[model samples]
Target: MTRLWNDPADFADEMIDGFVAANTRSVQRVPGGVIRRDAVPEGQVAVVIGGGSGHYPAFGGLVGPGLAHGAAMGNLFASPSAQQIHAVAAAAHAGGGVFFSYGNYAGDVLNFDAAQDRLRREGIDCATVVVTDDVASAPADQASLRRGIAGDLIVFRIAAAAAEAGAPLAEVARVAARANARTRSLGVAFTGCTLPGAAAPLFTVPERRMAVGLGIHGEPGIDETDIPSADALAEQLVARLLAEIPDGASAAGGRVVPVLNGLGSLKYEEMFVVYRRIARALEEAGIDIVDPHVGEYCTSFDMAGVSLTLFWLDDELAALWDTPVDTPAYRRGAITRLTDAARNASGDGRATASAASVDSTPDADDASRRVARTVLRAVQEMSRTIDTHVDELGRMDAVAGDGDHGIGMQRGAHAALRAAAEAVDAGAGAATTLAQAADAWSDRAGGTSGALWGVILAAIAAELGDTGTPDAAAVARGVHGAAEGVVAYGKAEIGDKTMVDALVPFAYALTEGTATRPLADAWIAAAATAGAAASATADLLPRRGRARTHGAHSLGTPDPGAHSLALIVTAVGSVLAAPEEES
Candidate 1:
């Protein structure tokens, strides 16, 4: 039972503010996150690390000399928006390039990739290395699918060290990938973590039992068993990590760096007790131990858990690991601190983009503007529907995926509704109105669903031109276009137990129904098909994304993305069904 927080929604922001204030000598607050107080070299490749806010010391604390140049802080347990990522990357960029690194969660992947794309378009070089070092998330053969955990420290350290040593962007990225490949981590949780202001834990372990392979964001473990003694727990952790040695790491002479990490509430003495056995286990196996770490490096709010990470080292990596580092949390070999005059000479290297904001009001015809108002109403109705069902959606996701879908949908829908009303005020047509809404939703949501929704709206808006009032056929074409675009972009088939399952049927139903029925009637009929398809997903197992590894656990629950889509589409259909005179 964790306590002490202001408004739950504002927790991440408040935490970041205080973090920067306390570490003013190490970091300065940038627009999206914190950056090193002193600027980087003219040609130094900037390494930017990021993740959700709860994992302190991991993201923000590591931003200083010999580590990350900046950290993109997102909402608690949520990935940063693409806009936020881009802003930080731009601010941290030096003459060489910018390198992005983070855990390989679905939301982080989507948003980071999008930001990388955006950066490239603006002529700033950017590359990404996703850390997938959690042994519990996937089988050894499928290591790419594993989620990153406490092992992020290894990857981020190596990457930043590579950059600090005058390595180019490619070298920095390569070293990061190598570190990720050689790293492996497994964790056990005595209890699940409750999000701020949430009534209950995201997932729970039974009394006298422990959950193995739990995620940082309170995602339930893949396996559960009776709790073990500290010695037995160390054995379990060591054996699991050693079982899957990376290529060329099986030799007795290979060096290894062991990190015993405590999630929020665990005591330091408890960690030392566990590390005692861990050290013996490694020594018995003839693996040379490097700078062994035992403390909280990454945390999951208030969860009582710990993870063991082993980073198999090569000569180059071994040398790099010993480099001096001075930061808010961790420190290594003594390094000369910048003089006050020198530090004051270098200011925060921030880059701002000037956005064009012009009133396009009066350009849209009266009829189109009226329809925009109707779309705004529909957006509001969809938001209300999502607000009513947030808890249910979250429950569906906690079964397998990180349990943040409900909160994510609520954020996206609210942002979209606000953007839609503003677009209406700007005298935007159906196309421009929806385009603005989609951008806002994706920007605020910052997840797989948000990414998908953004693409869907972009495709739909392309079909509905601003010049003409979009008729039933035009809207139907947009619907089908959206379906094709989503499938093409997300690469999920109908049977994959994603939102595609509902979307494909709804797309077909809308096209067929609109051929003869009124627009509102067709929308209602299509929404019904989506709703039924969403319900039917309870019988199907997830075959994509994070839930794929925990399929059995999620078997009885419908895909939350699909279910939320059904609810929103149905709600929006009702708004469309009302008499035109109502608008």
Candidate 2:
């Protein structure tokens, strides 16, 4: 699709115009597209940084009260020219002098060094610090040649705080250099992103694969492999960074601050999943994390990936890193309640529980149950039919997802059936049997869909228990409850093109059809609606879920989960519609 930019040549100028226009009170464009604001107190030393655009909040977004004084912006993924860098330095320099900071990219080095030379010749004291933190960018012996990633934020904050405290220009540079020494980062990408107005991605990873160590600007990665689970990815990243740190010393003394940054297009939820794993890994390694930040601090437009940054801290730099700083992109030192000891203890315990809780009894009914049961049965039947071809349903999931779906579902279903049969053998009603089934399903299937499905079945059983009898209206209520459960658990809605796309419509159809027809008739109509809804998903671009990484490739492929839901509904209808003697 075409972008709002008039052309590639005008893209940078247009972007800067919009940036300054929107941030008039906070920033202004100096000559050469450098963005600056008058330093907060006006007399403190000034920090200036310059780099290519795209890595927002780095060179430009960091310019503020406790960060940078000026930022020179360049064309997308291209370093700002030497002239531009010089202009930003001159604008930010106070009588105390200017401290220039930038990532270690060849273009940035050549240009910023030239600007530094020019500034010194003109009698303006200028100092420069290059960030080299990306472990995957170079071997240990060639650490100085590594590319910078999110650690730039930590280094910039330290330098800016020194400048804000009215430190000498040389001192500010020293603090920045020290911060850079303690920081390390690594990144992985599932897919590349497009430039504005571009027809195709700047780079590409193979379908259903991930490229690790990818540069933000679309540089080739270390290697491409089948997409790993969040836990696996986090383990890999944290291990590499930990190895980069000196033995027996925290990069931040005994404390560490982590930044889990999304490259772009990765959802906040997915990032948190990665964070959970990283936190566990760090804790295992005896690293104390004083604070953690996770978000899209840097981006390649719409790329589906993320990076991890770790900052080791000394008392002085840590104090500066914690200093009150506010900018459009970031905020620190906001007075949140001091974490209570009990609460902190509980919080740590909760992570363990979350990991262990997968085997617990399913919660009350929600939309997910109704939808999950329908999808589960359908997937089970599909597996039966495809069983001769392959041994497991996970293989089917592997066709489109992480390949755990088949094993997870089979295990959950087997658990559910066993639980149900035991309950039934104990003279329990269908409701009790179903509830037991739900608990078993949840306990066996531990990932996202597993918990969701478990909640759904248990909820349906609970609703049935409350009513004491099963009929058309009761079935309708059960379906409604199932839909609610899924929504509550997954938090996905219709157009996100998740299972909700089919479930929501099917639930509505069940309620309407049951009100006007027999139970079997209602189920048939609901199944038809569900099938249509599942088919309709083919036209939608997935806004969430693993499918999002595939972008346009995801379009025209019925969401497997949704399709499975339709199949389950159809199967249940057949069972309910059977002859009385046969039933």
Candidate 3:
């Protein structure tokens, strides 16, 4: 359980601030996250790694001399936004290029790929090596679909070591890919973790039971069983990993880096005891153990669990693994230090400022100003509505997925409202206001829902434009565009039991109703239809994303994403109707 937090919404921000302050000798504050204040060798590839914030010593704590050059930290259990990743990569890039690494998750893949594309467009050489090492998440044939857990350390170290040795970007990325391919991990949880301000854990294992194959982001496990002793757990983990040796590798007589990792709140003694038995078992099986790590490399907030990662070592990988590392958490042998004094003297640690652009507010037409006001009103209503339903939404999401949907929506909606208000105050038009809000929502929330909503808002904003008030037909087109954008971006169909389920029907109803009816009346009707569609998800088996792992356990519960979208659209409909009644 999280005991100390000023405001749940501000936890990530505050945590970063304190982390930077304490580890100033190792890392410096940057726009997206922390970058090593220490200078990199000239023309060396910058190893920029990150994901969600909860996994300490992974995304951020690894940023130092021989690990990650920079980390783009996101909100708890959420992937960093594309803009955030871009900011960190741009700040961290040396003369050579930028190499990106992170866990294999949908949000991380989507956001990191976007950042990589953007960097390439700007003529910055950026390469990505996604870590997929949790064997329990997928079978050997579907190994690419696994999630990276504690095994992230193995892949990250290989890339950073290659970079430190002055390898080119391509070679460094190749080294990382090799490590990711060879690594395998399996995790089990004795208890679920509670997020700050939450009433309960994301999911729970019954008394004397354990959840096996759980994810690092509070995602419930794929299976459950009665809790076992330390030696028994270690044997099970070792057996599971040994069964699937990397392609062209033999489990027996293999040189391996076995990392026994504690998922937060698990003690060092527990990990040590477990690792002892694990090491003895490996030796008996004729496998030679290389450098073994036993501690927290990755964490899931305060989840009471542990994971074992086996990184099968080749000659090249063994050399990379022996390289020195110095970070906020992990440290190794001596390396050249780039003191902060020298960094400050050279002005290398400060964020480079960009030239200001010309203001676009003056281009807004008078009619568009009125429409922008309405958009602001609806945004305010959405903020209020999300606040009211945050707890309920979390409860619904806890039925299968990680139970942060409500809190995520609250953060996004509030941030969106603030951004929209600022745009409106600046005399911006409808498109600009909505676009600004969209960016804020995605950045502040930092999850799959946040990214999808950002796409949906941006699609609508494109049709809103700046010159004049958009008509019913134009607005309907925007709604339809939002539906299309969400489906395309999230890759979730209507029957997949996601927000797209409600969005498609709402857009169709709005377009059909607007053929003759007023915008307000049509919106209200469409919103009602969306609400019903959201409720109907209770009967559909989830076929996409995280909920799919939980399967039948998610049945009888409305999809949280669809429910939240329905709530927001319904609130906005009322806001739209208010203006009509006043007129």
Candidate 4:
């Protein structure tokens, strides 16, 4: 039931047939099952890449003007036969000779080596490069034994560029080998993927858990753990990659390019969230990120996971990366540098802290301090509530989720409030206090909501720190900061039925002259809108987040997490707007 295939025995042949049919203009199927295509400047050096059928666009699909000149496509999760590889080598050779490249799988090695020997016997000059980039697959002493993941793209591209530039077969192979040596990859999978026509998945994963370092063919992962938030997940992946890269590997004189890739079926929003974290993590680690690529460069048949690839560049490989290459699936030389421009345009070429800008002038009513106190009190109260309802929340989540919401929220809120109180008592400035509080909450809570809430509090405090007031303009700016923080951290948009549903409208409302209106009025409007948006989620299938797995069952139940956020925001507004006498 998991895989749909009419004839299991002929699935491999049928898949190849379809591939050739679709790519007829670009690729030709030769005898022995090798697919050959034309690269730029034919008769120059030849770049060949090959792998199993399951990883489409990898070996075969990459054969084009800017990619591989030929590919020996194999069966699903199986290596191509030696004869198939030899046939492709013969068909692709254009006098300059051929450079063979593929992943470092056992079968691939056996077959490619045999094919290389046969080619040499025929008086053809040939070389080989095996890609082994998965750091989790093996230790540094045995990096060659690790499996290749998304990082294969970097290797393939480097080889193709070198070959297209008329490098000899030996030099082309050297470039690819160098890239493979510098490259490293790691991945985490939340679910297993089923091969076509198979009734069961290739592997198994526990409900609500994830497997780190899962192979493309559903191979066993290196480690298993609870599913983490996108930020945590990205951090874990990037940290592992950083540790693997040699010291000074990403320095100014060094070459480092980052690639954020999805396993399969991961939404673009989620991918973007992962990229945001990876970028931040790399920057913090003093790794200069260059030539970043983000997308589904590699896949595992709808597996819900992501991988990170780091290519430590040298001068030669960097030149190849900068080379122009265009293909149906991959493109280089046209990527815009908008991120750098946007960053520089924002004043100091650095991300502005929302609180730092607002801390200059205190509000006439001292509303900033009062609101901070109120927020702390609310978090404290919510912590107690969460402790009381932990069992109930766990039971509710258990019906369809991981059952950690209650505990996560309680821990996160408690940490935030405790940190805030301590900062205040220690005479820490508002912005510093909020940042500390946010960090504490995020460290303790450890979930999606924890990160989001931490970002929100930090942004609010940063904005207040800049102006030290609660004027109309300041409130608007604070709302903007909060919204941006939520988006930056959560990557949820206006209609994803996330906390954004409430927070966005509230922020927009403040932008309209309604900022001077009582905080309760604005909060009520925002909460009501959010509640409506949350209710609307009943009609939409969950697209992102923990609720995605339930499918239709997720419909008709207001997202509990979003509902909780609405309640908290409304409570804060009410407290802030209340008259002194009422308090």
Provide the lDDT at 349 for model 2.
23
Q: Estimate each model's TM-score.
A: 0.95, 0.56, 0.96, 0.56
Instruction: Give the per-residue lDDT of model 3 (tens digit) for 456-574.
Output: 88889889988788888888998999999888877789899899989999999999999999999999999999999999999999877777767887899999999999999999998
What is candidate 2's lDDT per residue for 533-555, written digit by digit as tens?
99898788866544443446556
- The C-alpha local distance difference test score for the whole of candidate 2 amounts to 0.69
Among these predictions, the greatest TM-score belongs to 3
Residue-level lDDT of model 4, residues 246-346, one tens digit each, is 54365334457988888776788998988998888888777777888888777767677788888997777788888776554666765222244443453
Q: Give lDDT per model, in order.
A: 0.86, 0.69, 0.88, 0.67
Number of clashing residue pairs in every model? 0, 20, 0, 20
Q: What is the per-residue lDDT of model 1 for residues 1-583, given as tens digits with 9 covering 90 to 100?
A: 6577998767788899999889888887776687887767888998998988788888999988888988988887888878778877877888789999999887788778888998899988887889998988888888888899999999989998999899999999999999999999999999988888888888888999999998898888889999999999999999988888999887387799999999998999999999999999999999888899999999998899999999999988898898788899888888677776876576533523322344454356777777777778888898899899999898888888878889888888899998999888778887778888888888777777888888877777777666657888888888898889878767789888999999989999999998999999999999999999998888888878778778788787889989998998899898988865774
The list of candidate 1 runs beyond 4 A from truth reads 347-362, 580-583
Full candidate order by TM-score, most accurate first: 3, 1, 2, 4
| Sort by lDDT, top down from the best | 3, 1, 2, 4
Better of 1 and 2 by lDDT: 1
Best by lDDT: 3
